[model samples]
Target: MSPLVKKSTGEFEEFDEQKLRRSLKHAGAIPSEIAKIIQQIRPLIHEGISTKRIFNHSFRLLRRYSQECARNYSLKKAIFELGPSGFLFEKYVAEVFKAKGFKVKVGVVKKGCCVKHEVDIIASRPDKTIYVECKFHNHPNRKNDVKTALYINSRFLDLKNNKANEFDEFYLVSNTLFSKDAVKYADCVGVKLLGINSSYGDDIQAIVNKYHLHPITSLQSLKKKHIHALMSREIVLAKSLLKQKKTLFELGLDEMEIKQVFSEIKNVRRSYE
Candidate 1:
């Protein structure tokens, strides 16, 4: 069951067990680990926080003594995971915006500091540009969520100051839903929040289910509509590999390697719809 449902007032109501399992799983915690941890902390979690916030609570508790361990096993993975997640999410948002007549550009910035901070998807129509930041965190708080927005906002300001023909709008997206305060902060800063689809949630669950069984990963094997969504990424990687053309054809991409890249391409192409 979904832990969230939109209320008449446009707010989301939280569920208990739904929060516990999803957050725990997102933090890279298995059921056994969560059972032990929750047995101890369940009493202390205040009523204000939902069950989903439990992962954040556990992470904060562990961060004091094992920063690197906590980060590597949980926090850092979630942060880095945002890059690929952003690539997928941007395709959806860009298509939606474009169908509504907005001009959308994907991965266009190729020079200078702008290159260092490429906005995921820029939705524009002559007079305005909208910068986007995508998040795929385990447990993003109001403060944590705002940090990326702040970075993007600062970057946008710098670009604008340099007369860089920038957009006036901004956006933030996440596979994980934001807290009330996170939404408020985004609104206050003129950042629009885009909710992720349930299908993506199912994809994460499938990944987790597969991991628990210690099965081989078939992410590089699945053929999906999102494959073309990877055009720019594949082009960039192919170019880099081409530059090191010592082995070229001799590198001899075996069937598995070819299948893997083909799977990646298929995944991106599916994103167009």
Candidate 2:
């Protein structure tokens, strides 16, 4: 019998080793490293083993093999580190859209048909204008619910009704997953949804990996205060750190720590190259 693994949500499901293999492969782990990691992990699989433990173990081992691959694997967790509040997340989302060639604005208030609404993101090009509402959750199991979909859709509707040709698209982007009802409601109302693994091809993970938009928090060397300092200076992306070496000193990192951070950032950037 397959050992049942406990999810972060307190639900238990049979462990699927193939899932782990796929994740490692996606993270750029070589065949030999994947095989070795699996060999070590198999013995540790027992009934009621938490997924968190498995992830931590795999991450530690993967980091030992390749820092780049480990950073790729940690992308989801790194995103969560962007916020206790959703402000940094909004900035990050704007950056993602900017990478896709959209002129982006964050936290802009636009007058709707009824009242003014402060949209999380406003991405525009000569062709189209997109309004995006970001739903960022620190916890993996916390999903964007139907109410969230409805709320964002209603706001979009108001804006759309105000000037139908003003915005071409409205998207609800979440750092986590969406509830089934949320997805259904979004599809029904024409509110496009983007989450960790949306049925839509342009999910958050896909976009991040495709554009090499990995956040600064992806670096394991940085502490929470370090992240805060960097973000305060509007330094969000890991690759951006390469150009701002002096900022690392401003964060109070010693010479060796700064070197280590630069090394890790280089490895992360090299992965996408």
Give the C-alpha miss distance for residue 244 in model 2, angstroms: 2.1
Backbone clashes (count) for model 1? 18
Model 1 regions lying over 4 Å from their true place: 1-85, 110-116, 137-144, 197-273
Residue-by-residue lDDT tens digits, candidate 1, 1-273? 434534335566653655665665555556666666667666765534543355557766544444333533432333233344356445544554564467878766523334346667778887776766656554334223556656656666555555455568666755555555566666676667665322222222232222221111123342232223333333212212324333323345555655565555444334322
TM-score of every candidate: 0.39, 0.77
Residue pairs with colliding backbones in model 2 are none
Model 1: lDDT of residue 47? 39
The residue-by-residue lDDT of candidate 2 on 82-142, one tens digit each, is 8888988898889899988999989988889999999999999888989999988877768
Q: Estimate the overall C-alpha local distance difference test score of candidate 1.
A: 0.48
Error of 2 at 196 (Å): 2.2
Against the unseen true structure, what C-alpha lDDT does each candidate score?
0.48, 0.84
